[model samples]
Target: MSRMNRFLYSLADGLKGILRNLMMSLMSFSMLIGSLLVVGSLSLLVVNIDAIIQDLGDQNEIMVYVHEEYDDSEFNQISQAIMEAEHVVGFTFVSRETALEEMKNDLEEYASILEGMEQDNPLRDGFRIQVDDPANVEAVVTAMEGVDGIGNVEARTDVVESFLKTRNAVNLISIGLMVLLAGISTFIIMNTIKMSAYTRREEIAIMRMVGATKGTIRLSFVTEAMIICLCGSIVSFFAIMFLYQELIEKAFSSTGLLQAVPFQEVWGGVLLIFVGASLVIGVLGSLLSINKYLKV
Candidate 1:
């Protein structure tokens, strides 16, 4: 038979093999989906945590308060000094009037009690300074303390340090879990393929006697494993996306407490990873399992 004909025959036989051993095929399919789900869920969690950390870093800023006695020229000098400071990416001046107005808005229910306090506004003008890196916030605060006309400098270094620690811990744990699950999944798949080949040993022997090439026999089994894995990957991808959407709607969309990374931004990478992993596991497992049978 021609090589093309042999390939087509093998492919058809592979489909038949799945139906012939439906129960085992189903077991393999379920295990693949389960493994994918666990890994994918953890991946999503890590992505969201990373997003939250980034947002917090962006929001973190050093507050530099100016003494109430500084004139406009001194304020301009202070601004110039801040702009020249190392690690200072940006700074916005908040006038005492603006600060008082913001406080009034925040205390809307008690606005009447503070209606006449504008003339005697006790708020101080300040600069909200953005650092290029959160780790350098303390350095920037220290530099600002020596600047003339600056009364106080405040920063939340402890909060940033805590967040960094949490991110590291989460990443280490997620990576360990993913590796463990992947190893278990691969082992299960390898054994399942081996058992399937064992059940068809008689047929394989007959094919060998009839001059069927080892390549053809191997392709048939590999194709069968690939088909099962592909189906499981497709199902798991959709199921994961569905669950993510549900989570976004129920937990994040209405409450506005936490933001989720949009599926639109990540689905392509997730699909590619799932499909690639499935193909690798399928091909590797089939090759390893069928090699023993083909040795005869």
Candidate 2:
């Protein structure tokens, strides 16, 4: 037979296998749909939470206070030294007078309480340093502390540490969950494919005896698995979309800051990953399932 004819026959056999075991095929695809949806949702949640943490980290700057008695020239030197510090993106110098004015505006109702303290404002001059990376904030703080004319470094180390810990915890949990789900999904898919291969064992044996190549039989089974996974991935995409819509409505109150990633922006990559992963699962499942039968 021609290669084209062989291809046609293999495609036909694959479709027949799917239809012959309709219930099993449906169950396999359904499992894929559910698992993929869960994975996609978790991925979006992790991305959104990370974004929120980063936004909060950006708002909180590293406060480096200079010596109160430092002259203009000395302060300039300190500021230049800080700018040269690693991870220091930029710095703003707030003088004692400016700090006093800000304090007054903040405590307008208690203006009388501050009236007697104006002659000896206790506010110190400080440089508000913007950190280039939140992960390096401690390093920036340590570097600032070593600068000459620097009196103190006021950093929310606890807050920064907590944020970093949250991000790391979330990341570790997400990775673990994804790995577990991938393994389970792959196991189920392999078993499902094995069932189909087992059903056709006698036919495969006869084909082998008739001189039909082992490659042809493997091709047919692999093709069947691919078709099942392709359909499953496509259905899973729409199911995920529907579930996400409901989730945004009920699970999320307002789509302001902690919103999940928009499906539109990520659907392309999601679909690519879903389909690619499904294909991998299907192909490997077929290979693993067909190994014993190949000897026939």
Q: Against the hidden reference, what TM-scores do the models get?
A: 0.84, 0.83
Estimate, for each residue in 47-76, the C-alpha lDDT of model 1 and write its tens digit.
877777677779879989999898889988
Candidate 2 Cα misplacement greater than 4 A, ranges: 1-5, 97-122, 249-259
Instruction: Provide the lowest-lDDT 10-residue window in model 1.
Output: 247-256
Q: For model 2, how does the per-residue alpha-carbon lDDT over 75-97 read when each residue is reduced to its tens digit?
A: 77897898788877788988888
Report lDDT (CA) for all predictions. Answer: 0.85, 0.80
Task: Give the distance in Å from residue 239's predicted Cα in candidate 1 to where it truly belongs.
Answer: 1.1
Residue 245 error, candidate 1, Å: 1.6
- Error (Å) of candidate 2 at residue 33 is 2.4
